[model samples]
Target: MAFSAFSMTGYASHTFELPCREGLVSATIHVKVLNGRFFEPTFRLPHALAHLEPALVKMLREALVRGTVYCTIHIGTLFALTSRPMVSSVAIAGYIEALNEIKKHLPDSPGDLISAANLVGLPHVVEFVEDPVGHEINERILADFSTVVEMLQAERVREGAVLADDIGTRLDRLETAVEQIAERSREVFAAKRQRILENLQQLVAQAGCTEDANEVQLQHAFAQIEKLDVHEELVRLRTHIASARSILGLDSIEKGKRLDFTTQEMFRETNTIGAKCGDAELGGLVISAKVELEKIREQVQNLV
Candidate 1:
């Protein structure tokens, strides 16, 4: 399958006009996303259209994996046709009360300063009633929302492609360093075995040990020396590197957590090799691999 990735951040918006009894009314929908540990969504809808929030959130959850999603739907018109501005009695009463107090404070204030024209112009005193939308128009808005979601996912995929390429390069460097470590480890193991054999022979000779006794002692000592060999750790490290590459080739959007876990495993094996193998050159290679793994970990966090 082709390699694919998805970022947890993106934004998309769409605006269109729908025919209502009050002539053409415009609806603007926006979807914005940010990285998160799970799918979290918030919606802003007009009071008349609040019923659509549940369905819209479900749609986004299915389309995305991990992010803080924000969606807003605004319905309005340039001019009213069937509806007229309505005055709020409560707002006017509060304004008059506040204005009377102001007059008391300033006894010589101009009467026209607190006139009806001023009250009408104030916010919340007069609000335009919105015409109700039919079920058919709501369905059309839902369809347009799906389109915008697809656009957002497409952008995320494009950004993920860039992340995959950069991470792939770092993995390549790590693999090379691991191979070098493996080569150096073999030489270290052979030289250490030779020194152990020489020391054991001298101890056996000074003790006047028989040939059979000397052989048994050598076998027992060599068994303990094998603990310092890094062959097993190197094998596991290569396996982890392969697993990470396999994860990158997956076409699913669930790569981040899995890749992160594999990176931790790589660290585990690399650290073991560094501890067991005391060769300075092998230590340098292990440190280099660790640096590459850290870079890969940072990149995978941005993936979805």
Candidate 2:
């Protein structure tokens, strides 16, 4: 029930002994995860434990949000260490009878060919006796597996904290750059407005207008200048940055997706600001903000 950022990539392995009524059973578990958009889990277990896959997958889904997860469980040397070896009398007898039939066809065949040692070497002549406490062993395995998954979760959380810290630093830079851009944008807008006024005055003088320009003409000129203003875009960029910061502060499992979307919006606003502002200094600031946003986007992709 822990709520915190978790990275989509992590690895954890554990080797321990599971005590059963039969004896001590050694088990090894490996959990690896890679960045993915969905919960995709792959399990590699002994055929005898194939039925445990669904339960294991349920455990994983409860603990993880999104990743390509790989789970490998080895139960003590292919289930041999947990079970005892037994000689199958029926199989040995069948092998001996078959060999005798072959011997009747070839009277000169060597008797050693059908010896006990040779028959024991044949397939199916020797079998492993399954553990008497099979259900208990499976339960123990599930318990151990849960522990390993918790270990994996801890590793992922640690990595996520690191990523979040890095991203927060980058966000600070982006926010600062955006503030600078906003400040510079004001200056650029003033300069643009002044140039527009100068041009309008020149046009008025060339036309030999004696009286001041009418209100409708002045309003039209101001409106044209406002069209090139990036104030709204800069405001949205700031809002997006704040949203991203807030998401980073939350204890939500799906913050990665939210941050990603916020970054995209920030990019859109940055592009709009760049397109609307023609000042060289403002363009440079927009570019710097874009670089920071790109870095944040990269880190956000690794979060869960």
Candidate 3:
């Protein structure tokens, strides 16, 4: 079977209300799949989500096959009316006093430290705002992942169809070559028998054997040589080829492995035919057919 480059990308978003919190949280997720040797997942997330990276990667790896997948998730928070800002007046007063004392000690230094510009730049000095809820975001990401997986499966099926067609064509070519080899081999057998008989006659005459005895021995020799004919190999090869074609027509995930095994059987039978026939042309054709089968095997490895 032959496979094309399979890929898919999807994005989805959803909003859900959190229990005990009178507000909605929204999540947007993007999923992408590209050809690769293994399942490699990458997560580009905000610092707030650093802890969730491991869990996300594990989930994606469990569901995905061979590909480089990228997942991006965005979470947004909507606070309720009751969520009011809480401020510590004493903390703010103490911060100002500490800054004034530092400026008094170092008169040459910048004394305008409590200005709006400096206050804006100070770490942890801003008015506190509500943190975004993320459970709904996680749920939405899972939903989007499900959709992406379905898309990937559909792509694989479409590519498998193309692969099956290509493999069928190659199988047909191989069967044709096998038939040619078998037909030519039958002719070679007749020529071989004639040559063997002539050699036997010359040997008997040189040894001064009587014509009657020579004739009997030559008949026995010819009978023994007939056992090497490849008629059985040809029959088995054709049977295996037919079975392989039937397998290609079926829509099964195991078709790749099954076809590979059948190819091995076909090659075995072809080798047997080559050895039995001992014809140079048949050997060459068998080798050529085996080469094509190997190429097919390589393509099948990437199949489902």
Candidate 4:
């Protein structure tokens, strides 16, 4: 099966059991990925599983693509039940010597060093004895790591769903902006034609020529102005926008690179419209559309 697209928000927790010299030891692992960057994985293990670091890293590398990942491994018996008291023989001897020196100066009291030895010798210290589970511990850690990876991937898919919805909203806004640009393009052409006509009439009056004499010249001027029309550019821009929106709706993960390329095409078309139209108001509108497209492009970079 294909791997799910990488996402920045995800978390997984799991436990696995492996055979040990004393039966089986359970290893609990937790993995979390946030914001699509690999976070450091922290491993907590009983002394028995410390040797399994290499295997755990290998398993994690296989499962995660992007995001900060955290993995914690816990193993062995939870806590020692019967405590073993540890008394310091050396401490007792030192106390005896001090008591002898103090007795030389004063009558002995119950608080003397000699009396302290009895209490010191009975100092309760618990030593935790760990039975190394050897390779079995490593196996358990690897197994738990596998489960955590799978869980994290599922979380990534859920987060990706939300990202897809946000992208859809931005695309809708961009499409509306593109349509507005197309409409304004038509007005630009009409305005340009009217201005040219007025200029031609003013020139005829200055030259003391009749309207009939300049009729052919006026037709040629109109043809030249028509050649500069941005209607074709506007049509192409809208078509590109539609294609990009369709690409966004795809369930595939390969849409990022394609959407990035489309953003560039959209910018090119908007630039062409702004330059060819030569209307200040249309230019400002094109600029606004380009700004929105850039923002959309920035958000698309995070899409997987």
lDDT of candidates 1 onward, in order: 0.86, 0.84, 0.67, 0.66
Candidate 4 lDDT, tens digit per residue, 76-106? 4433311223565675666667667887877
For all candidates, the clash counts are 0, 0, 1, 9
What tens digits encode model 3's per-residue C-alpha lDDT throughout 1-304?
4423222222233333333254554545566665555677887775555666777777666655456777776555424411435555665677788988998989999757667676555555555565553675556555565665565567666766666667777787888888888778888887887788788878887898887888888788778678668888889989988887787666444455567688888889887887786778878888877876776676565553
Residue-level lDDT tens digits of model 1 in 106-179: 88878855768878999899988766656787788889999999999999989888888888889899999999
TM-score of each: 0.77, 0.85, 0.64, 0.58
* Quality of model 2 by C-alpha lDDT: 0.84
The TM-score of candidate 1 is 0.77
Winner by TM-score: 2
> What TM-score does candidate 3 get on C-alpha atoms?
0.64
Per-residue lDDT of model 2, residues 184-273, tens digit only = 999989988999988877777687665555455677788989888888887888888778878887867778888899999999999989
In terms of lDDT, which candidate is strongest? 1
Residue 59 C-alpha lDDT in model 4: 67
Worst 10 residues of 2 by lDDT: 208-217
Pairs that clash in candidate 1: none
